[model samples]
Target chain A: MRRLSALALALVACGGGGGPTHVVSGVSPPVSAPPAAAPAPAPAPPPSEDASVEVGLGEARLCVRVGGHVHCRASDAHGERPLLEEPAVEGIDDAVSLSVGARHACAVLRDGGVACFGDNAHGQLGAGVGVASSPRALRVKNLASADRVVAGPLHSCARVGGGAVACWGENGEGQTGSSTHYAEAARELVVPTAVAGVSGAASLALSRSVTCALAGAGPVCWGRDTTQQPIQNTPPAAAPWLAGATALAGGGEAVCQATRDGTVACRGSGALVTSMGPVALPPMTSFGVGASHACGLLADRTVRCWGQNYSGQIGRPRSEIGTNVTVPSAVPGLPKIKALAVGGYGACALSLAGELFCWGSYPGAPREGGHEPSIVAIR
Target chain B: MRPTQIAAAVALALAALLDRGARACSCFGPRPALVSPGPDHPAPVTSRVRALVPIHRAAGATVVLRPPGGAPVAVATASRSMGGVDLVELTPSAPLAPDTRYEIALHSPGQYPSTFVFGTFRTGATRDVKAPRIDAIGVAGAHANPGAMSSMCQSADTVVTLDGISVSDPDRDGAEIALGVWIADAAGRVDTKKLPVYWAVPKNGHVQLGRTSICDPRELPLPNAPAVTLGVAAIDESGNTSPVKLVRVALPPARHP
Candidate 1:
């Protein structure tokens, strides 16, 4: 039942302009109603509607999408700041979504345009090399409209108006879907370029050394297959299990697809089915894959995570459960979540009430910052 | 045996003895001309002894007072090969008495004559306890590849060459120097293990650089928070450690495909 002091809450309010600020509620003691023997029970209330709040996790920072604006806080630096406060992105507040990379972030405006900020050593900001690092968001060059955008560790890709995919930044491993190898091609592309052989891409997913897209047919991935995983070279047409996949997720060396049948099929580094053995699986609505782990949000609103648990990234204590969680296990003590986001060393869940909770070795967490999930205050 | 045959055998033995003497170990140190005191100090004074050839063993090396006065003292020796030269160093257990003359002797039982004086030295009145100076630190990549972007990368397994280290000792006392490098992450956590480098002396203003790959097991799998700091320290013959010189490098995250 720990409560943040009023002074601490005041500090969280100092950085950003006037807006609806969110605060974490303290755990309340259990209350008991007066016992009236054999009294009739009242009817239960109906379930509340899902809250609309977007949360993005970076290596050392976290941002929340609220009221058409994004507010961010860094672990090392105190206070919060508007993600689009820079002059380059001024007067633009129709932010619909945000994607955070290792050191940078990108936002998709309601007008279908993309603006990025932060580190650009490899032109990840899409503003070219001259603008090495920018605190303000810059419009992605030559990208008139974008339906969706996903930022990876060092690169970024966006789904254009016609479902066309464009990528920029570090191409060392051919993650940009370019035919040329990083050693032979320009290391950093200042502006976005059309991904070769890819059209009508419904969505995009990026991993450490690979990128995959959900196209009309199914999921196709391309990049460095460091471990010779199944998602290497062109699309994966040879696997029949991915024929009717509606969504795709990428990991360090693997890719998973959510099929229309509510089941998930994965390849490279072994599929979740292989880990779960012959047990019956609940219907999955979505998937979140990290560098070495994966999780699925079931239709029942419960989350089941499996794979590497080192640093407690799997929502359990490594010391208590050992290093690897071969099969899916329920994440205890977490409220029913609407979505989940897994990072290289941590994972976060967005509750139905718009509360954000995170676990594992990510920065700014209480205690050891791992072993257990805790509520995060994103004002 | 016949007299002529015996005489020939004696001659052969004498020739073998003379050959061993010819290859006796030769020791060297700071030039005597550089040890003058006061304003005429041509070079810094030092007590370290270096031999051209490796000494047999530490037990066979000894330093004694001149004129055969006090008892000979057994000294410790360490051998290492550097810069195409084999060097054996001699360090006394305790400081030699001031204003005293000393001679270093080497005895390689079966290889060389037992009674050979490697070199002679004179102890100065002043003691050198100041640490060595590290002027600057420079870093570069091991290989020059046209495709490689700026030498540094987001991967923790990047190899870099620290060739621009400039080190100098005021005493000019030791023939070898030890250098250490450490890395610190943004959270102020320092890598427990340090990269160690050894360099041969008589550098004459020439600096010897070493190469090392940056891979710390403790570093998180994610990209470096913002930057990583590298620090280098120099250690002198007198056991004095220099203040660490630091360099900060920005590591942007690796781009995903």
Candidate 2:
């Protein structure tokens, strides 16, 4: 039983100002505990709560509404926080989102279209041309609307009706699909069309070119197949290194999938990751990808992340992994996190309470500093 | 319970709680902050700056640039007292002269506190010179059909020298030598001597590549096989030649079955 060191505990405590260190007492033993139940329905009117989601946007400010919109603000040398907000309109309708490249942000909309904003230098924004400053909605032309959208460092994707998937932006290593020629459009992948025969693609795991989809059975990924990170698509036959996956996320060079059996498997860049072992899963619900780390939202509405935190991506440390936290560490003091997003060097979580708490860089903002706000009740 | 036994029991209970807490807390979490190094001196230089920053702030902390054996040239200064964080860009009052040795001293309040960055970078000397000299010869590399490859280098026996003199500098309000390179076969020629590579999806989320998938390397995209050499070159503001670098990769030896 590895325990969080005193320094890690201090850092964690410093990260979140409110809340005493909790010691779970009577909770079911992790060995046989069932995944947490699905979260309750969100409240109306954007949950008069505090900001439940906060991220350290690159030279940008971040804010989120529990079951609502996610916003990022950045200035041009001048001190001004331009509002860049995108709202989620689906049941639990909050479009889980994350930042990519430098200033780009993408969100999954209720209508199944990916809404993107910020720098489009490499056309990474996906919201083709005519810059969208204030979340002006747009969709991929000639592409089916998606049920969810996952944003990578320089590329983005949306799961369409059926098991079909389309991606645009950078495709250096054919991570988007097996296409040989690069096309910057919502191009269809007719052959090997379905991601691992996924009858219903629910989410996308993107790492620049490589994209993995979470289906009913497990996770299936395509593009950029290396030895440590191979691409397999045989059906019925569960993929090696991928099974019981309910949610998936891609960060830096590694990809992590949440298994229904309450554990996680990650590969790429050869970094150590957390294993649930006999621990119970809270039901894989949502996940986000950062530059080199990933975070997931559980059915209980709590948040957990693994991988590097050189810039505080996984908040304050909890175990010996602080110097370079390789495995998943439970974020201290956060309660019932509704949705989550990961960016270059930071992560943000939207709490069911509608209070937006953030950990990592850009911690000077009075209200949105890295901690749960006791005063602001989200929903 | 004895004192030691009681203490041991407490420790065990705490460990159990910690384990449960660890798993319970493993559902989802937050991202980190933006801490990527912007433009800066190399890593070692940055480390030096961090170590020496505390002493420099005695007086208003500032960075003063001085040229080799010349009067102090106040190129850039720190507006605010930085806490040794790496500075992204130092907008000098004027661009430094090319091919000159310059010393950058980050002035903290105390004299010993300041750290000096020393380097000699040549500016646009090559720009003032004529375009890059290209020695294009008949098909010298792999070609199963010698006549075919030779035909590609038709007429022009002499290498074309794309002079940097004609390069334009848009920012300086005029043209600065922006010399590029390309190959021209007898049948066709490149419109511009520039690299065609574009942005692509990040491989592993870092290495920059074209956004699209890779196509057949042999299949040329241009309408005609515009003989393009390997890479391109650019000159600086000063008259410094940017090391006439060539991009024409040597073709593999041709094999005939």
Candidate 3:
């Protein structure tokens, strides 16, 4: 307490108080402090229950919901921001499940309703067909039983009370599980469209072009493939490679899943990923996938990552980035984690003790800091 | 497109593109530029500020700006503290020509002297009044000839390609132009709303739209409207539209049944 008091006094003396402190765990912005906004280089957010974080695939921004109130911070070319100081999504309280798309985000509220915010270019927000974007979270029309929600680059899907899922936004690749009927209203579905095929879905793994569901029928995938090949639109097809996966996370053109037998299977081009074999990898519980990389949390709470380290998203030290990028390696210096979210080039891990450690930040100069784990104060 | 439609389209495209560029790689801007987008910065720079090009740890960095089809603009380099980050800011020593696009070549000291294409930015009036111009359009997938729209039919789900579509803008770089493709049935019912603007650039003077099922034109209503048509257009920083090219995709006879 005495040490903290001294530090606070020093910060005040240095003019670090009274400005809107967008304090979170992040390296200072690339060029300079943001225009007039205050950023506090403070410690991590204090530990608390019912806290979770979601990072958009390919990472648009970050949002952390604690005790039902959601705080978000987005990075722009303008430099740093007092993220979380201003709630990106106003009135996003009591969210039960959440998912982050490339430029948008959605959440399943405890009331069984779904709400979304951010870019609505393709109508991912589900407010209306022509609604471009939303500053506040808006409720979806005609959806009231979403079990869980998942977001992709151009669309969002919600798993309802049953094993079915409802989707909205761009169907250019039939990602909305249906084709555009060649009408303006059909191009971007303003209301949620029930995803056809596959029922009893246990979980959903969605990327830019691929949407997969793990269920009793094994792993079924739809939408376009990595090479822009159109897959099934209505009835999702079984991915022969993704059989019996327990958990799934994906990004870029790759999909990686963890099995019940403690085996992690990742199917992607050798250019973007490497297998976790030759030497047996420890069993994993859940994992996160980036553009060309992936990270999995072990039952023991340690994290192991593999694939491209172009921006050190693979979690290796700065010096070791180009080395063994395709090799599945362990990310050092992370505590036992509770949840993990991976964007195209970065990854974040929330610890059981309420600290969030993120790496692979490319804010400026191939070094967004946190090439290793950097504490982000979520409060 | 209507005025309201144009506003909405630009708003949607810019919003999504900005969010994407922000989280993608080394972002270049006038006020607070990000450094070192690695060997290749694929994400387009969206800043309209043309005063400062920032580079981090650029003590020995060399900055070069080459305008489109013109001579290189000379710049003086200096170090300054902005927002607590060490920046090697590159300022044009002389007034840059108005309404021009410049390709940037930056070489941080210690790397090879040869500089790769750093990225690009547009310099002109604070509020852009000009629009982008798309000259040509080409497709590389199954489609009925313009003359045989009724007789020739193609699969609705076949992935289509928009190759050799050229887009250029003097007020903004091609990176700033939002290009999109919309599919409409014979009844003129469109599939994608707002054309779904995405990152498009000129490669070898052609808009690199790549391949997409975005033109997955809906299976027509019936025999009366048995064909789907695709229209491609480009929207500029000011939400101005280019000359649209419409390609018709005729479905097989059996598809109607």
Identify the leading candidate in terms of lDDT: 3
- Which ten contiguous residues of candidate 2 chain B have the minimum total lDDT? B29-38
How would you order the candidates by lDDT, starting with the best? 3, 1, 2
What is the C-alpha lDDT profile of model 2 across A226-297, one tens digit per residue? 433344221223345655554455655556555556665655443323322212345544455555555555
Evaluated against the true structure, the overall lDDT of model 3 is 0.50
How do the residues B1-257 of candidate 3 rate in per-residue lDDT, one tens digit apiece? 12232232222212122343334322222222223111121222322212113324356645555653246566655443322222333445554555555555444444321232333444544444466677776653443223322112212332344566666766645334545455555566554434322223334544422221111111212233345576666655434557666767544444322
lDDT of each: 0.49, 0.37, 0.50
Clashing pairs in 1: A154-B254, A154-B255, A155-B255, A175-B257
Q: Return the number of clashes found in candidate 1.
A: 4
TM-score of the B chain in each candidate versus the native B chain: 0.41, 0.25, 0.34
Q: Chain A TM-scores, one per candidate? A: 0.73, 0.62, 0.76
Alpha-carbon deviation at A273 in model 1, angstroms: 11
lDDT of 2: 0.37
lDDT of 3 at B172: 48
Q: What is the per-residue lDDT of model 1 for residues B1-257, given as tens digits with 9 covering 90 to 100?
A: 11222122122212221233434322222111101111112112344444433322435433332312235655566544321223345555766566655544443333212223333445656666777877766663222223332223112332334556667667664313445445555655444233222232213333322211111111112233345565556654444557776656554444121
Error of 1 at A132 (Å): 5.2
Instruction: Indicate the residue-level lDDT of A166 in model 3.
Output: 79
Give DockQ for candidates 1 onward, in order.
0.01, 0.02, 0.02
Model 3 segments beyond 4 Å from truth?
Answer: A1-58, A77-84, A181-188, A225-235, A268-280, A362-368, B1-257
**What's the iRMSD of model 2?**
22.4
TM-score of 1: 0.49
